[model samples]
Target: RPRPITPPCDLRLQSQEVQVNLGSGDGARRSMMGDSSTLLSYYHEDAKTMYEVFQRGLHITGERDGPFLGSRLPNQPYKWLSYREVSLQLAEHLGSGLLSQGCQPSPDQFIGVFAQNRPEWIISELACYTYSMVVVPLYDTLGPDAIRYIINTAEISTVICDKAQKAAVLLENVQRGDTPGLKMIILMDAFDTQLLEEAQKCSVHIRALRDPPGPDDLSIVCFTSGTTGNPKGVMLTHGNVVADFAGFLKVTDKVIFPNQDDVLISFLPLAHMFERLIEAVVICHGGRIGFFQGDIRLLPDDMKALRPTIFPVVPRLLNRMYDKVRA
Candidate 1:
């Protein structure tokens, strides 16, 4: 007989893998759960057409209220803004500057997002849509080679990343000829006089991006984990992600109701599709997104401050949470 399964266990969970259900088919065929499906009905109509699920959703207000995740931390307090406020700001930013001058954004133009998790990531993505430029997100855990591959593959020119991740970009590969298209690298963590000086020295331009990226344009590029050979870059166009977005909304709606000011704590790597989709949902709903002070080790303390309403995680991470709760 096989050994009996024990009730008390000491199984340790790794943090690399995240688990989520991806729906079948492309943009037109995909069925998303949660708020995604409801949002998709209006955005994605054709059954066979590949389309981007942009624009979080038509703005709506709910009666319930609470402290959103990013409302206040440290010296801050909980303040809420409706979905309309956030998405409109995204639209306004996209319409500014060189972005609005063209029918289709130049291929030489590219935007990179290198943050951990926060409103900046979503805002940056939305701005890319307005300008019709492609948004490339970097994995925090990726080595310099992987990072270089993404940059080179996409021919990325402008980049927006966290201050903590700047060193990686400045390392041997990036410093060498590995990255050719990289021009601007903006640090999201820049807060004080030092950040301003860094910006001046690096000649980094810090401002909101404008113009809603066309629905048919490629919105984001996600690279798969190179489990076999070189990692395959999964090109998720706006439609591809939007389909998943709708499917996610369909499933999510049956379980919980979301509001624009709802608090969300994001712990997954933003490069992953699930996290990116979740970020999109958060943007559509108009909620506050809180960046953790550090890694998973510091999330508990951060959680106390953020008090997230919706939390997404891989099975391993969830198992760890269960273990901690039991302890």
Candidate 2:
């Protein structure tokens, strides 16, 4: 005799068991979402793509002027960047600004994002998605040679960079005639006039301003050094990332993240999948995210100031923190 499967409200979704036969029978295509197959199909869902992730929040909150999240430097109070559910948001404006500058929308068109974790980085990424363009993140680990290789390989015409020192690195490549396709470098923070002057000499346009809401979708391309060859790119479409978010929530939502008034200190490199995945989950749950002060030495100060409700760290950092405390 069969009885009821109780606990109606406390369901904890578990990952499907791994199977040996991937392409046989009702195989790998079989999923918890009975009808869904490719993760990229996440695009066809309610949000459509990452471009809509923030705007969806705006609709839910129904707020017009308040900021979507927070980010700031040391000694300064946290700052907010208003993200109304507008045809009126900064992301759209950035996309339009690029369009006005003749950077047209195309699935193949790529933009390089070289910045630390900040509210601006997310906004710039959303802007890329809105414009039907892709993001190729250039991180510190990639260095100059690889940065040049990626720019030429991706044919990136514009970049959104964080600091003048970083912009100077990209400009060095430009001066060497390595990243010829590169045309503009948008600054996320204030810089000395020297950067602008240097930019002019390299035939690059540099500007520091608020930018965005464009609609549509794009993808991401990350690079890794090949074992025996040069750097190689691995592209993840909109579906790839959002699907990760959906899967994470189903498994952890009820147990670990039941509370919605969540806050996170975002110190991880957004260029990596793990941190971005953390962000996706947080955003889905209406969580607040704050960045660390750029200096690792000031991380404790940033944490104290941000007073986060959530902290995500790797084993390496955990061990370092433990050792520091013990010492």
Candidate 3:
């Protein structure tokens, strides 16, 4: 049974009256230990309540617990966020209030997350999930033309970009105006406060004005690389994410809990599904997350500070590492 709501008023006076004999044939009985009894009773009443809370609209990444854990940085100096912070902030940003205030929501909320792999990328993706927004993740290494096509094809309205991809976003904006959906662009660094303020004023509303998405709604539209030409958006539903996460838990059940303190060095592009999935896992676990200060070029320095437990990589990065080792 779920627990009942307890108000502050009744907390102080709460007491237990049960007393039992330990050597009795039925079983060992016990007496209530003042605060212990009240605590047990409160928790007992809350069991069902907690379960229902979880069943309501819990997210694997955004919720308080799943996979993402507390800070894994060896000599924990500062506090880091868990999946809850990532999801809630994302929810607030992508909520109806914000989306309706001219900023678009999912399906049509063409927001591009362009950067190399990092916790922010995953948080941005989760934020998209909260509002059922379209997520267009651009490869960090793509040329200007490819970048232009992706933003144009998606008709991106807003772009959540890193310092490296800021130039590409602007270049695409300058290339054309036929993109009716493309309206505002924001930056994550907070360096360009002036630009951020200006972008916010554009009022390019794209949220499904009338009907907002539910928890089970389509959360993101990821684009896959095309052999022939432009990439195609792969529509992923909230259900799909839940299913995938469940599978992941099954396989990594053993290491999931004990290694919850593992730190992950994210070096892959946020655009890649593998990195995205791992980020999702990290969010689900309420783990401590840190961003790489510089690009992959400064990997040695970043690792010295991070010393991540889980280091995800692509074939290209692996090959480079292998080459370096040989050298």
The per-prediction CA RMSD against the true structure, in angstroms, equals 8.9, 6.3, 17.2
Question: For model 3, where is the 10-residue window of minimal lDDT?
Answer: 41-50
TM-score of 2: 0.80
Against the hidden reference, what TM-scores do the models get?
0.68, 0.80, 0.61
lDDT of 3: 0.52
Off by over 4 Å in 1: 1-58, 61-91, 94-108, 164-168, 171-175, 191-211
Instruction: By TM-score, rank the candidates, best first.
Output: 2, 1, 3
Instruction: Give Cα distance to truth, residue 90, candidate 2, Å.
Output: 2.1
Candidate 2, after superposition: displacement of residue 140 in Å? 1.7
Considering every candidate listed, which one attains the maximal lDDT? 2
lDDT at 13 for candidate 3? 46
Root mean square deviation (Cα) for candidate 3: 17.2
What overall lDDT goes with each candidate model?
Answer: 0.56, 0.72, 0.52
Best by TM-score: 2
- Candidate 2 lDDT over residue span 1-327, tens digit each: 546434314345423554657555663422443223444434224554566665565554454343456878669878765456333667788878877777878777788899888777887777777777888898888767888889999889889988889888888888888888889988887899888888899899987746122223447888887786788898877766777676655544445652335678888788888888778666644556788877888888888888877777898998998999999
Stretches off by above 4 angstroms in model 3 are: 1-79, 82-97, 104-108, 164-175, 178-180, 190-216, 254-259
